[model samples]
Target: MTPEGKALLNIVILGLGFMVMFTAFGTCGNIEQTVIKSFNSTQFHGSGYTSMAIIYAVFSASNLIAPSVIAVIGPQLSLFFGGLVYSAYIAVFIHPYTWSFYTLSVLLGIAAAVLWTAQGNLLTINSKDSTIGRNSGIFWALMQFSLFFGNLYIYLAWHGKTHITDKDRQTVFITLTVISLVGSFLFFLIQKPDPEPAPSDASESLLPTDISDSSSVVASQGLGSQALDAFKKSIQLAMTKEMLLLSIPFAYSGVELTFYSGVYGTCLGAMSKFGGDAKGLIGLSGILIGVGEIIGGGVFGILDKCNRFGRNPVVFLGMITHFVAFYLIFLNVASDAPVAPEEGTQMQAYMQPSVLVALICSFLLGLGDSCFNTQLISIVGFLFREDSAPAFAVFKFVQSITAAVAFFYSNYLLLQWQLLIMVLMGFWGTVTFFVVEWTAMSTRKNSDYASI
Candidate 1:
């Protein structure tokens, strides 16, 4: 590769690695997952979905704070430290330190938040709009695959024909701990290429290049120029109409994706990733979802109706497809009727309705996740000018905060009242439906926000 090409290649690899570590947190970081699955019964008892959700939410809660740290310190350090934090968190579990679990949860949330903002900012400045969306799409899709890998690795290690022993749970923590440390070393390779100034109409400002020893950017100092805020503005400025229109149908899928990614592993453990009819179906579900995501993300690039029907319809189709998947899963869950296997050590865990529900949910969630992410970025690009970095950044910041709060709340509810979280998620989906439809129609009534 030429010097410039090499830099780009390295950056992309860094970004990809960053995603790998970031995503590894979802599966490998879940202490509840490793402990509950490995040590517990074949039925995958007591995930503490509520407790784990709270832990996960506590970890996610740091999004409220990490952007400030990132804008001040900058992206490279955020990633380096984030990796170290993950290493520490995993090691805590490896040694079976229960007290560190809560503290580690919060730290992981905060560290990941900082890393996400910094990397997002870096990508915004370094790449073309189309290229950015495409890269983001690919990275997001690939990141989804990481969970499968984590599952495969953990399942194989446990190797439970009938049941997994708790002793092997140590392997899960150790594997992740090592991976996190290795990621830290890789983090050193990340270096800021250069700083670029925000445009005249820029609602947000990029960090200045005065790399202090502490490693923060200008935006990190409570300036609130974080990506979510930028993203919101870009949507409001460029294609408020188009986005609201698209968002009407698109929001339901978003709710589904968030809810399912949060729960898929729990389902897999109960179904067994390595064996049985349920296990076979569980594995099949994951692969199919990954494949669906690829197809959905590709659609983001090819859609030509953004100029006319707005970007709403593409999202609409994506949501409808997701709805079908969810419906199928719900039926499976509701049935509660058991399936009898003709062979092998059929544990009491197989043919679980809840696991079936989650499988259906994961597939639909994956489809929407793969499609919506690329579509969202592309939609922002269509709505905003090429130089609208600040706007997009703000958009991302808001989305992050909202997502963070929602994640926490989901867990809190799960803990407080088990089935309530699902009801709430479904209700949230209902609300999203109206938001998308109303926003789309309302935005279409006038060309007011059509500057781009």
Candidate 2:
């Protein structure tokens, strides 16, 4: 196969690998609260939410060092090792302990930082400006399929019941472990691209020559030097006006994701009258989210490829969708509503307006999320080009910190307050996107004039 054909093939394989890994680990991440709440609410003092906060906090910290780690090991090896760390974290459930759980959270955090940093770098470096949106869209859509199958497995495991038996929990752990292992193995099949030469004219590059060269340079010095340089580059990028403007929306996306993965399932479980079987209701919500994401990704990718809409318009639509979903959630659903069984048959209960509203909220959240996330990656790739590793690292850094803060306060806040905060953030994010787009257009016009 030609190099171009091989590159495309590798991208698809990597996407499929992530789909498997995410299905396994994503299921654990999404539904763990319900499972933990069911098994031993006292294990963390019913503070699974706090545990997640701790993980993202550590993840935020690790982002500072992750880029250097990827620089040393390369993206493919970084992904392989990171996948193994994820599998180990999943295996922790077999012999559960409080200390072990928190310890693994730290490991998972570091691993996540490495894995995602590598992924963004790999995808950006391999793609061209014209096709970047489509690549990201296809990749995200495929990865989200894990949510569908993972939730499907949970639904089957519960047997339409709300609570999970000890046997079922054990089976879940084992199955997830095996699936993660398979994903790690698939990373070995990916071939890393050869490094491109540094641009001759520094004026044409977004990054300095030293930093651009750093991408091709291995860690020949001591670990401390490599880390120091990486940290400096991260700070430099973070301080750029474009990066700051883009960060507002990126950080808000983090909070939105935390709500869907952490709080949404809990809300569904709380409203169900079927006892432990209510967990199945949460699974159903996840499936709907996956379906929405698939549709959103496909549509956005097509529009982008056809030049039907600019990135700003698509992102604006996403912000509006998110605002509407949150508003509906605030108005129609009550987390503290009494859990009396429906007056009629099971099907009638399932068809209740409030329940249906919650499900639709889940779908819209996923759809809006896909629109923003795919565009965020594509836009960053377009702006930064060769210096994408540090740019993506900073992006993840801001997102992690924001998400950590959201999860930390999540326990203290009521559902109404949480939704209100998200609405406010969404508004600010949309405004910031407008600023970022305007800046980009101005910069491009000047560059064109200079060329003329």
Candidate 3:
């Protein structure tokens, strides 16, 4: 075997490229700090909150399609495309122009979307049978670095500035652009096994069969029609009480993303009246998540290992963690702290204990968040046909589409701090947890994205 094969050197190297993929997506979190700052800078003006919401909506919505495109183009080409967007539009290598800034946000959304599909496909494709499980472990473990790296990037950008000025923003953009380019170039060198053979039965299906071919597929003929068809099929298949319960966890996970990636820090700022330092806490929140992932990561694998239990318990654990974590945040904000047991005397409700509790609670929230993500992608592979890239594409698409709406509701519509609000989010996950448990999906290694 070539060194790249015997040692899987290329996959190892491309992990950096994948790192860029994640950081690209992760930059979304920084929007709360950056977008508002840009508008306030007088470099741009208006209630940019709407603009921010639109950007997020675009990011969330486009990410779904990105994977399907990645499935078709292959990872290297996708990375190249993603890199170009990062360098050109995101201007992470230099101060992006205002037009570039707006354009970059759109492109970043699209690029991030593409990266999700491409990297997941790539990583799964690259894993040699002996190494796949180990790689999966490393994949999740290493992704933590993206959060760390992104936070560091923001820190340096604001080293001396009161806020991230346009100049500072431009600097950050330029850096990522160069990095994207470098990562893109490297992808051309990495090789993996071709995806599993296209399903023979697909020839019998009404949809186009050849488009699923990775090397030959084009970007324009979207799965637009296929997406709807697949949705109906998945819905039809998922018609059981257990299937309905599986939907529960997804809602919680969706809300968690909105809160953490989309609005936690901003919410913190909204609570500025309470002396809460939202911005200062934003970067650190990732640490809480990382710490949580450590625990969840250690434990979730065992759940994935249990063949008889299927994925239910692990998925359940992840969902429960997320649900509780969000609950703490919800309660912290409302501070029914010191509910006055006697009901006659007023007590100083806002105490240090409550503050510490909220912060710790936020950390746990991140832990559950991490596990859910790890379980989620794996479950996608577990739940569907390995060769069914088209189906998984649909899966990814709905996830993004739904979450886009979730973000809209969280910040754009119901911008309030309440535990009941989280229940709405929890509804999806609660259903999903049961669905996976009750469903009879096989956990066999999918041959489609399997080995070289």
Candidate 4:
């Protein structure tokens, strides 16, 4: 196959592998909270939130080392190793003791950092400037399919049961473990891209270059030296005005995701009527979130390819959607309505005006999230180009840190307060994004004219 064809094919294969992994892990997103909630009620009532905080804190720290690790192993091997680590985390669900849970959380944090850093490197290096936005959108859309399938499985497994039994939890965990292993194997199928010249000559390349490529040259001197250099470069990159501005929105995205995946599901589970069948209800919510993301990403990708509305419009739309969703959620909290049961109360509960409101809110949140996340990836790849490894690392670092803090405080805050904070952050993120993009665009125009 031609190099271009091979690149496209590799992306598709990698995306499919990611889809499988996400599907397996996506089940854990809500279920983990349910498991923790159950365990906590018996043991320590709010340990679940503390666990989440610890996991994300470790994840934030791991981002500091991810670029160096990816540099040593190369993106493909980084992905393979990361996938193995993720599979290990899934295996722990079988015998989830406190120590095992915390230990695996640290491992999962490292795995996530390595996996995402490799992904950013691979995608940026392989894609052309003209297609990066679309590529990111497509990749995200495919990965989110996991949300849909994972939730579907949950819905079927629960089968209208209000509560999940120990047997049911075991069945789900075992199934997810097998699926995660399959995903790990699929990583072996991805063919690595050829290495490019070091960062000094990166401007000569037509495509975006991997910052890790520079580490390859530096590694010949020594591993420790290579790591130090990568660390310094990442710090330098993070200090740039553009990167600093962009970090706000990136951090907000993390907080938003935490709310949707963790807090929203927990809130639904708290409803007396759905409390028994929380797993199923949360699964249904996941399905809606997935559907919204698919629609948002797919539509925006086409528009991006055609250069119809540009990045800012879509981002603005996303911010607006999030604002509306947060408002709706706030209203729901204020109303404090009761949820009726599933059979006689099932349809009424399903059709409960507030439930419908929340579902719409979830869908909009997903849509807005897609818009912000895809564009963030695209913009960073475009602006940083050759420095993408450090740029992405710093991006993930800021996001993880913010998410960890949000999760830590989530237990203490009221739902109304949480929504209020989100609304304010959304507004701030939007303004920051606009400022950054405007500056970047202006600089590009000036550069073009100067060259002419």
Predicted candidate 2 versus true structure: per-residue lDDT over 1-452, tens digit per residue: 76566556666777888989988888887767666655643554334567678878888888888878876667788888899989988887665667887888889889988888877887776666656777788777888888899888877777556555667778998999999889988877776544344535534332222312345343345555665676677788889998999899988988998898877776666664444556676777888888878887788864454344357777888998898888887765564421222221132221343667877998998899988888788778777766777888888888888888888877777677888888888889888987886676667764421111
For model 3, how does the per-residue alpha-carbon lDDT over 81-198 read when each residue is reduced to its tens digit?
7767655644422433355456666666677566555555555555443344445545665555566666555544443333445565556555665655665676666654543345
> What's each prediction's TM-score?
0.67, 0.88, 0.71, 0.88
Write candidate 4's Cα lDDT for 43-149 as tens digits.
23334556667767887888888878876657777787788877777776665677777777778888888888878888887776767777777788887788888
- How much lDDT does each candidate structure score? 0.48, 0.74, 0.50, 0.73
RMSD in order of candidates = 7.3, 4.8, 7.2, 4.5
lDDT of 4 at 76: 75
The total of clashing pairs for model 4 equals 6
Model 2 CA deviation exceeding 4 Å by range = 40-46, 194-216, 219-224, 273-277, 302-308, 337-353, 445-452
lDDT of 1 by residue, 1-452 (tens): 44345445645566457545643454553325425434533432333233344343543445444545555566567768878877776676554434465567667656655665555555554545335545455445555555555545544554434443455556666677776676666656655444334445333344432222323433343445553443443444435544444443233333344455544433444433335444333334554555566556545533332434444455556656655654555444322111111122223322344544555566666676665565565545434433234333434444444344444454334211322433444444434544653564466566432221
Rank by TM-score, descending? 4, 2, 3, 1
Q: Lowest lDDT 10-mer window, candidate 4?
A: 335-344
Comparing candidate 1 with candidate 3, which one achieves the higher TM-score? 3
**Clash totals in order:** 40, 6, 35, 6
Off by over 4 Å in 3: 1-15, 24-28, 31-35, 38-43, 46-52, 55-72, 87-89, 92-101, 127-136, 152-171, 194-252, 269-278, 302-308, 334-359, 412-419, 441-452
The per-residue C-alpha lDDT of model 2 at residue 411 equals 72
Pick by lDDT: 1 or 3, better one: 3
